[model samples]
Target: MGRAPCCDKANVKKGPWSPEEDSRLKDFIEKYGTGGNWIALPQKAGLKRCGKSCRLRWLNYLRPNIKHGDFSDDEDKIICSLFASIGSRWSIIAAQLPGRTDNDIKNYWNTKLKKKLMGMIPSTHRKPPPFPTIPLRTTPPPPSSSLSSLYNDCSPYYTSTNSLTGLESISAAPHNFLNTSTTTSLAINCSLLQTQDILLSPLQYYPVKDSLIMFGGDQASCSSSDGSCSQISYGKEIKQEDMGLHQSHMISNGFEENQRFMFDYGHNGSDHSLNTWSSTDLKPNGYLGNTALEYDLEEVKQLISSSSNGCNSFFFNDESKTQERALYY
Candidate 1:
């Protein structure tokens, strides 16, 4: 079987919607409300489009009282922070932003920010340097009875005395492994000593020489208090081939210091403008939401434009992915 069609797939209107349809959706929604469920909305609103289509139309276009125009500095900071902490949860990201949609935010990240990030990589095809293997204790000491051992059972170190150097022990009795490794379950009492087998997320530890990949976990990026990653900056002495990767690592540490900085630079104007808009109580949907819709309309427009132009998608598992990339921030 071929399968069902979306709105008959024949006369179904595609591309840009007419102003008349926009008016109908706007007027009907204004009067009767969207009732929260978009699928049944066309029937209730008496529109020619399907529910999903209606939802998209309203979310992407017709929704009014929108803040249109240029992306302010705060938007940039939020984009960086949100992307760093959350990879591609547009809805979750949109919630943090007052008047943006998931579709809109997704589009901006993919089209604009993605290009900005990739551009930071130099044109020279220099091979990135090999990542240094962190010198773990050459020999892992025997596990104490209190330690839950690794299945790998690879002992590269041996304890010399009853006293563990803390960094050389395998059975890290005093180590709080949870604070270190998300993958490994080695427990230790921090009061005794720090665990040697610290696990770093692919994002947390990108080698500065390689602009091709960023690696590390959320903790590796910054303090886990609010899921914000940090950013660090290296001087110009670093080679161009390594700047992107180097900046990526430094950014995680450095950016954390300037989390408030990005906001202060980018958002002060937006905050004032938003407060003015908020005074009107002009809802994006015009009726249904308590606050404005939790999505970025501008981001949605950009996404639609990019998709129409055959652009790649930039999604987040959460906000951390974007925040981890320093240049983008």
Candidate 2:
């Protein structure tokens, strides 16, 4: 059965709130408060509006200390950093900035901030560059070579090379190479490789035992000491039918296991710069640690500054231009 509606649909006013309606809502809430139920507040306030509409109007427009002026440069940094880290969790992002609401940030992001960021880069760099393919083989690595050393020999750019070993194509570049855009590219590439028939060369292959040894044998499955258990296949091809099962396995185990199987890259530093950012952290999240965070801020500032000369500039260096741009917000 269909659920009952919250209020009478035909009797309620639905369009933009009139000035008289706003005054009544503001006065009622100021005097009697919400009575702890938004669904019932509108009727008590003597308004014909829906409770949801009244709630939105009261919170977004009539709330005290709500700032509707232009967003500052620091606000822009906070928004961009939070967006890069958490992607569109507007309420969480809004919490970081006082007097700014989630709806305002979301609208600014969609209509202005997104376009400003995209316009900073050339059209060519916006698209992912072609990646080189690795040949498939079953040969083992040299006894003296470590996983970290082997991955370091790979190239950053996706270009063909004569090296027979498949390690040359993998990226061992520093964390600075991973910006918001490159991280996005990596995410796309990783998703495509998992779904598609892309193959990796033998040099990129590592036995389950090797992964256990490299990652300090901390994984639950790696705790087994039997030689037979260590011989389990690590880099076998996954068919489309097995994707769901594979994902379930990943959920049970963790993404680290999937990373171990898919990318043979190694972490060398004590800080583990290659580790992805944690979304829960209050600070800026960067794929490449502190360096990436700094780069992200600089990039945002540069883009905003460069766009000052445009017809619809959000940023202004001149004091005179600031007042003009302020009117648009």
lDDT of all the models against the reference?
A: 0.36, 0.41
Report how far off residue 24 is in candidate 1 (Å). 0.5
**Segments in model 1 whose C-alpha atoms lie over 4 Å from true places:** 1-7, 120-329
Clashing pairs in 2: none
TM-score for predicted model 1 compared with the true structure: 0.37
The alpha-carbon lDDT assigned to residue 158 of candidate 2 equals 22
lDDT of 2 at 297: 25
* Cα RMSD for predicted model 2: 21.7
Give lDDT tens digits, candidate 1, residues 1-329: 97575555554466677888889888887777777776667767767677778777776555643345555544543454345333454554454444455677778877555433222222349652233222322443344321112101211121112222323322211223212222221111111112212111122222222222222222221111111113222211223333333334333442222221111010112222221212133233212112211212223233334434542132221243344233222
Per model, state how many residue pairs clash.
Answer: 62, 0
Q: Residue 195 in candidate 2 has what lDDT?
A: 17
lDDT string for model 2 (1-329, tens) is 99988889999999888999999999998888777777898889999988878877876677665679787655654565444433454655565555666788888877666544433222355563343423322354343332122222222222222222212213322233222222211111121122111211111212122112111111112111111122121122223233333334334443323122221122222233343332232122112212111122233333335443342222222442332222111
- Which candidate achieves the best TM-score against the true structure? 2
